[model samples]
Target: MARNIAFGRIQEDMNKTSFFKILADEDLSSESMRLIPNEFWRSSECKILPPKVTLKVAWGSSWPVNLSPFMGCYLMERKGWEEFLNDNHLGDNEFLTFTNEGNNCITVDIFQKNCVEILKPLNTSSSNVKNEEMSCVDPVIAESNKRKVDSNVYGASSSSSSAATFSLTIKKSHLTLLSIPVTFAKEHMPKVRTKFVIHDPKGKPWEVVYVPSNGSKLFSSGWRFLANGYGLAVGDLCTFRLVRPKEMVLEVLHDSP
Candidate 1:
């Protein structure tokens, strides 16, 4: 087995912006890539073949200084290739770490503008893309309906209809299989850890949840299976209504002391 190797370099040519351009324009192959720590590749004891495309790997910020064009494509694909991103790969200023466990560990610390690409092995045959749907109840309509029913007991004239009052058109392309956001209002923050509710003009509602970031801001935009089954039309209106903050109903065991 070839021993793992580590390398780093400051390449003015290898920044994030430029890397993507190279990835899109270049057709990389295993033979064209350089195996670093020169001695590791020269070792006759370990028969580690060069990485194949579609390898599953984790990339932090650092690694063998420069990544091959094939490695760059691996990152783009592994990371969902979505440009709608918010940097979330690093836990802190720590250098990006890439590891191919049982094979080799590659670490690098490029300038912030450039990122190191790590190669990971994966089975592509099993990872098929499927069309799923998303469905969730709308918060605004749920609350409004509850209030109207409550007011009826007091003989108050509840003129408000069950149908929603205000709704904005949402594009189908904006929603994913996980009910995630493709594009959303930058100003609106979904009440901390909660989903975004969409109330329709008819007072119907839908919900889209957020997947917590795992050292990476990039997320697979997906919606619930149930919701997607119900066809969504472009230009259809939806509303987001604020709900009361979720609170613990029971006291913690430690609180009694």
Candidate 2:
């Protein structure tokens, strides 16, 4: 599968400025949007890459994606990548270009299906933006709304919010599904399998289901979304603070790899 891959040279050919990737279904299901060419992996410089990298669009938008070595290739993690894909509505078979801008930053140029021509997504007045609107939210507006939520709700937290904060050191299992201390859950969580909103530090809301099983409490389904967004790893610390009857705020402190 590695041989005859659909990607450009990493650091040698074409002046070593850029590489291209045609998206695939496995990338979506596995939460690895982009893979570095094998040439990059074999390069001496690849040994010193940072744990994270910044992905930039021509527009004034950027995402911080975690970089990990996988299956002899480097892959962009779920944190910044999935959000970028969802926000931009990028689909399978879409073409992408990664241009190294130095200092762990890569400028991404997106191409429409079956074409090498780049699309000017930031040109809102252009037809391209109109067409994109038919599939997903405008990337610019979605990002603005995200910031709005952060500013608005974050400032609204009161002393009452701190009254209910709880902290836990993350374990390997927490990456799969977070477990709430039994004592805290029994005292606060609804007895039934109920849906409640969880606000990340950015104030983005995740509606997670709280399940009680044999005196244990677990956050399921939606919790993974939040975990992935923040790139939670084992040994990280998480603190959750109840802000309202149906809402709580979460803070994640990642451990050094």
Candidate 3:
């Protein structure tokens, strides 16, 4: 009699996003660091990225980080990385957190010893100012001045908010069913299957079923027909915005020079 060997199925974790903390090596601190492999870029968990993604590194504000392919791997260039390290006064053994911020951007938070939080005042008092002059100022004028100061402090713009925008890159496997972020699905999707109306870049409306994740609830589904109708391919970037729970707007960004 011959014995048979059985292999167990490989299970994938769908809830986890690409996250890592790296110590400041000579190259990473002074030069560039290699990005995760192509498989990671193409993985269902990482479909929210483009082949040539724009990484906006943010500490207090955001700055564009250069990325290019070298030796079969992407490299976060030295120019911006060096400036970021030097500006933050990072040294050896300092820990840096790299997290995806959606829309092809990443946030880099620096952690070092002896860090302290300091609150800075937005405005300073002027001793030369007279109480009589302040008292005479109109209430409406004072409110307008405060609004201007607040806008300047927070960098507020007149443009629409981008909070509702969602980005994803197409994969070969996505043609069957698109994988959605676990947290997003839990908060936005219905418990049972539902229909969603999505508008494409050309403003064409599409109706598709939205199926919430089952079991561990790692991912959500229902985009096969939409992906096929749009002729999405691997490496193509798609952006979506939820106009309502059952309605959404979509935009496809083509690769440019």
Candidate 4:
């Protein structure tokens, strides 16, 4: 399926408005989130508001979030939501307030228990990468790292002939989790949340959790281990070939095509 991913062109800006989101399990697990519908932008007709907006935080970092039209509202698409969630280590019950501080920037203030704002980034990534990689990484192409490749590298084309395969251009924002394309999810992914094995290019199996909700799928809950083990970084093009119903082979190319 040709996914129409032209997010609000990714350049849309927001009108002056404010909204809040209380993180829920489904929202956390899925690839997108819906902003509460309000008077300003209740639909695409409300183009005066941004379909895509920049998310700014207290710490001064900014991320671009794509908002897709949904039932009378906009959905915070997966493009930037994953990185935002992972970078912030957002958990259930957390409260997030998005205030449009002019210039199409949506300022994010994250809060937790009793509505106290969280100010620091929660560091949960493993520090010992070599040890972690050695535990579950397959013997990959040792020489691929030394070369500077382009950004379009792929193990398989998005126009893949096989229903069991897909390719992704990864970035730093997606290291903690990866969203399975909706078309792929609906056809190949398990409907119920399940555990699956993602084997590195060299055949080392990394067990990760599959979360499915609202017709979306994501590899979460242990994905970081796989990313760390594979040594996948921003700009790395990775191909996922499903060799078995519950398993896949992950091929990583450090450079672009």
Runs of candidate 3 with Cα error greater than 4 angstroms are 1-159, 215-222
Could you give candidate 3's per-residue lDDT for residues 70-122 as a string of tens digits?
66766666665554455444455554445443445553434343321111121
Model 4: per-residue Cα lDDT at residue 138: 19
Model 4 stretches with alpha carbons more than 4 Å out: 1-163
TM-score of 4: 0.37
Per-candidate TM equals 0.21, 0.39, 0.35, 0.37
Candidate rank order under lDDT: 2, 4, 3, 1
Model 1 accuracy (lDDT, Cα): 0.27
Residue runs of model 1 more than 4 Å from their true location after superposition: 1-166, 177-208, 211-222, 246-257
Better of 1 and 2 by TM-score: 2
| Candidate 2 accuracy as lDDT | 0.60
Candidate 1 lDDT by residue in tens digits, 1-257: 00111121112112211111122122232232222223222322337433421211221111222233343332222232221011223222223322232222222222122332222112223223221111111343234323332222111232245422223454554344333232332222332344433322222333344444423221133244323544544554433332211100110011111
Evaluated with lDDT, which candidate comes out highest?
Answer: 2
How much is 215 displaced in model 1, in angstroms? 16
Candidate 4 at 28: error in angstroms?
51
lDDT tens digits, residues 1-257, model 4? 00111111111234445566678767574633545455534323334767676765533445667777767666678757876777767776787766554444555767675654453345536331111111111122111222222222222331234336688899776798898888877766767777776766443567788999885588999899889988888899887866444556788888754
Give the range of the ten consecutive residues with the poorest summed lDDT in model 4. 1-10
